[model samples]
Target: MAKPQDLPLELLQFYLTAPYPCSYLDNEEARSQVLAPNSPINSHIYSELVRHGFRRSGSFTYRPHCDQCQACVPVRVNVEEFIWRRINRRIFKKNQDLTVHHQRLVFKEEHFQLYLAYQQARHPKGDTDTDSKEQYVHFLIHSPVNSELIEFRLNNQIVMVSVIDYLDDGISSVYTFFDPTQPDRSLGQFNILWQLNLCRTLTLPWLYLGYWIKECRKMNYKIQFQPLEGLIDHQWQPLAFAQE
Candidate 1:
């Protein structure tokens, strides 16, 4: 593993944010090591940052920097050796009807509408459920790297949308939102399966899935893809060893 300081990024600086309530865990607090705002982060610099367990949210690159807990383990899937479980295969089969379209990082009313509905349906109790159009744009559309917006449609109706960043070594699944009404379709799992295929198509070896917390039920889905690796003690290791 290489230190982030050794990366070829010039004038790159990191600062720890004030502790706040943890989003993934209950009754806990969390902090993040955020890259300096307005830092010149391009695809090359971001690729190195991501390799070091950092993730992009809007124009910010950050990683979990909790003081007492190391629950947020950065994880990625090895595309070459990813095991397609029965459930994964079923999910792929189920979403075979969805048509995928790659779009630029421009704002789309249709995408915003779906995103709003998804937030309301999936996370009614969450703060983002009531986000305005400006907030949506700032969160998902604003980027400083080579990012892409992909829409998954079924019969001309938008069903899901994914924001992904293309790194030198692989594709990063930044954020995904789907039609929460069709839970039986398992669009979320299908999204990961689709990303794996996209990685293979691009000849990339990894698919960054961001942080995974075992104690968080929502994040447990990340481990469903077998042979996952997690960043532990600054080293990437198998999920089992990383958890330990």
Candidate 2:
């Protein structure tokens, strides 16, 4: 086994496997391979991999490698050309009363409680019953690369939190949880909007939104963020809604 630091640039390759039981699909199986990047030139390697639609996971990176099904498309927002539409502007105003606290990855009891609430509300019939503090830390706080916890607070109380990975090219949103009781606020949409704003402020050209599946209505919201590019046939192609 090669040490993470010993991996060479030329050895970095994207591999795929046969599809297995899919997490998102009822009868489909998800197949993906480990993306090993040369850690010696970590930042440069990460930047290159991300351009190819690979997402970081701790010290290693990977993307969907499903066979026969190419529904999981990697999407990225071109920050410089992004225009906030009427709905987006309205969301910004709705969340104006909420304060965003960006901080280093830190897990607390309160965060776990909120995580449990989000899972129970959003995925009650799913495998989200495991809501222990250790599980929360392992899932969100344990990371090998630079990561941050963006907490959204209203009335001095934490309502939403997003675990984000800071890659060389752009920010990778690992996961997010919020108080599901406040459905009217639409925290999920607000989180993405906030991330886009952060990227613009930092002058980063892209925001690596993990994957978009056409069949999943829950994931379809990603397409609403216009002027995004989707990885198609190993190339980034501009997705034009007008043509659809």
Candidate 3:
């Protein structure tokens, strides 16, 4: 594969992957239009691709190219204009003591255990529930560009970890998992709020939240962030939400 800059100016090389199980949708298949592998996709090149709805996982960058489905809509938060309402503010206040530590993209035994427990509780009998350390490392640790493993601690005990990718215009939320025993704390919601604050603190303009499917309740939580932009028809259209 060629580097991003070395690719043709007008047409980038992309290959369609074989049909695979759709992780988000039940009883359906999924396909991806993956950008050519073995290419150097740095932050600068990735920023351009992200604007066109591509998301990164490990070293591969891909977008949904399903034959008959377009339900996975790429959405991003306009951090500069994000409306923080009373509920969100309360969540922040509650999680004020969450000490965040940023680390390199390396695997930790504790992190892997937390991942296992999280999947066991939330996604048992799923593909990731049986993931080994090697699989975990391959899924989250290996990256070509700037990536971070953010740990959120409460009272000096690790409770959550967020894997994020820093891009030119904003930060991409790669994945996150937390101690499932503390459901009342709403750590998942708080994690996104923290990342939103990080975007503002870093003077970034957008926070890519990956794909949001209106039909999937598990994926619909992203819409809670107001004034988002969704890639529809290859155009970033401003989205409006009713007041909570």
Name model 2 segments beyond 4 Å from true. Answer: 1-9, 13-19, 36-43, 57-60, 128-130, 241-244
lDDT of each residue in 1-244, candidate 1, tens digit only: 5454346654588899999999888899999999999566778889998999999888889999989999888899999999888888888998898899999998888888888889888688877544888888878999999999999999999999999999999999999999888999999999999999999999999999998988888887788887899899999989875333
Task: Please provide, for model 2 over 115-206, each residue's C-alpha lDDT reduced to its tens digit, 9 standing for 90 to 100.
Answer: 98888887778764356676677678876666789999999899999988777667777888999989888889989899988988887788
* Top candidate (lDDT): 1
Candidate 3: pairs in clash: none
- Comparing 1 and 2 by lDDT, which wins? 1
State residue 196's C-alpha deviation in candidate 1, in Å: 0.2
**Could you tell me every candidate's TM-score relative to the true structure?**
0.93, 0.87, 0.93
lDDT of 3: 0.87
Distance (Å) between predicted and true CA of 109, model 1? 1.5
TM-score of 3: 0.93
- The window of 10 residues in a row where model 2 has the poorest summed lDDT is 36-45
List the candidate 1 regions with Cα displacement exceeding 4 Å. 1-11, 128-130, 241-244
Global lDDT for candidate 2? 0.78
Model 3: residues >4 Å from true position, as ranges? 1-11, 128-130, 241-244
